[model samples]
Target: MNIFLVPYTRWRHLAMALWCGGFGLMAWWLVLALTVVGGPKWAPEWDGPILLGTIAAFVSGGSILGEDNLRRTPILKRLLRGVIAVVIAVANTLIWYWLLQLVIPKLLPDAWSADAADASLVSLRYRVGDFLAGGLATGIACAFVRKFDHVVSHVAGGISSALAAGAAWYLLGSNFQGLTDLYLSGAALGLVWGFLFGLITWPIPDSLYTGWIRVLSAVRFGRRIPVDAPDGGPKERFVGHFPRGLDLFLPADQGVAEMHVSVAVDGRGRYAARGLSLAPTRVKRFLERVDIRYDPRRPAPLETALSSGDRILLGEGEHQAELEFIMLPKEEM
Candidate 1:
């Protein structure tokens, strides 16, 4: 199984969000305590609060899990991603502060109060900044984890994060002025935000697992066995007749064994089919229509690389079952 591209479920996503938010509450307390003890006394009035919120965003962005629970992503790489998140969070905090607190007030003199420094924490400008900052940070963080190449995935992450941040800011009354607010609204906001983030950005059963085995000329013609494994971890399917335990259950009378054939995607993203049944599975590639029999006794493994539109014949005579492999386009993911 390829660990990197494993699909992410909704429950896992919500769980991750909770983890981040729980950490966020503690992070707020830690940052506040540090500010009171050693932070610059002459720092701007908004500095401490902004830093606290930014750190919360850092937690949410950095704690996002890309792979499934069974696999362990390298700790060093995850830390590097966290550091990148910190940089993004810090930069966003400064930029938004400058725009909303300094520039916007001067630009809209009548709309903004003269003492903008004393503006309400629930102000519209602050909320807007929160939305933009949260979105940008989340998008970049997801892209970094996905190897910085999946444009659609990152875009989805940005939109979801932005919406989550905006909703939290608006619904929670936009203030973290007290410990009560920090713990209550903070944890609630994290739960809601993380769920939304996962809803849109979580991986699907596409990419390497994007295919299906369709019954061609069998008793159950047109039946489909999806390429995705149970729980979306391994990109392999076990075709058999033993009922519930198999990935693809076929009729036993059709020359299929308890484990007939195993189709899987290798680490290099190539699909291969291995014959397991003593009944000799026959494969015909998409490019070549001639039948090729798997020889398990040979030094080479009894397997063949599969392509879209390939066919696998499972039995002999009128009782034979033919299954066709159909691969979907990855771009659709």
Candidate 2:
């Protein structure tokens, strides 16, 4: 039996994961601060009406900005995109809270007492609803700012909204019952945090997106034929099982020889392949090193065979040579 592994490479995916994970950690810390550390110091005063309004403002503002920054869209588009994001986030938060309320107590009865569990369940629902309303309102406010037609004013509005939201959350802590409410209350807290944090971090997505797009565009390569024989005859093609777009090409006449192929993109964005032939090897050894780049765009299969040579340029014209070749896509191999 023979096993082949395909080479995979995608820098964009890695960058996106890192960016999202980094912000997620910060969001977690904010929740911990408001619920565990601040406690009574942040709760609302006797004027419930004023406190509630403040909380609403912060929650909505944070949610709008946070989601907009993440999506790499202009704040001016907040009405459409921000509202949609808030609805989705709220729905997801509510579903998560409801599921946890039903499943958590049973899973860890010792962790939560009967009365504590009941209070938590109720508190969670209220927190989810409050956060949803806040997010919606904040998004609406941002929509108005979009009409201003200046980046500076838009940013100032975002900053003001975030500060207002944060202050609101700090004053209305009583609306959220206790630590049990944290799970549901976290979204509301996120609303405030997102608004403030989002304003501060607003420029990040633009810069990051610009840099990321340039790098990806530079590295990308279009489909090209991998030729082994000049005239193109009975050639063997070997494919690897990798789903990503990576392949190798070996020309005929190098009997049982190995090749070291290094691929890179030039300033022009064309993929340049440098092939270095290796010493003769047994059947098993030959199979280990040799791989192919399977391109779906091409009508014919691309295959490569190792030969006795120091280095060979793939695109350079060479005389036709008779050779047996096998073609296989990376995934199938």
Give TM-scores for every candidate, taking all chains together and pairing residue i with residue i: 0.50, 0.27
**Predictions in order: lDDT:** 0.58, 0.35
Question: Model 1: number of clashes?
Answer: 0
Off by over 4 Å in 1: 1-16, 19-26, 29-44, 47-53, 64-71, 113-121, 124-126, 144-147, 151-156, 159-163, 173-183, 204-333
Cα lDDT for residue 146, model 1?
58
Best by lDDT: 1
Error of 1 at 332 (Å): 27
Clashing pairs in 1: none
- Residue-by-residue lDDT tens digits, candidate 2, 195-276: 3434432323211111000100111222233423223222222211223342433333322123323333333222323333
The sequence of per-residue lDDT tens digits that candidate 1 reaches over residues 39-151 is: 75644565534643454355545454333231354767656666665566566555654555566556656645564545345454544654555555555555665566665
Residue 151 in candidate 2 has what lDDT? Answer: 42
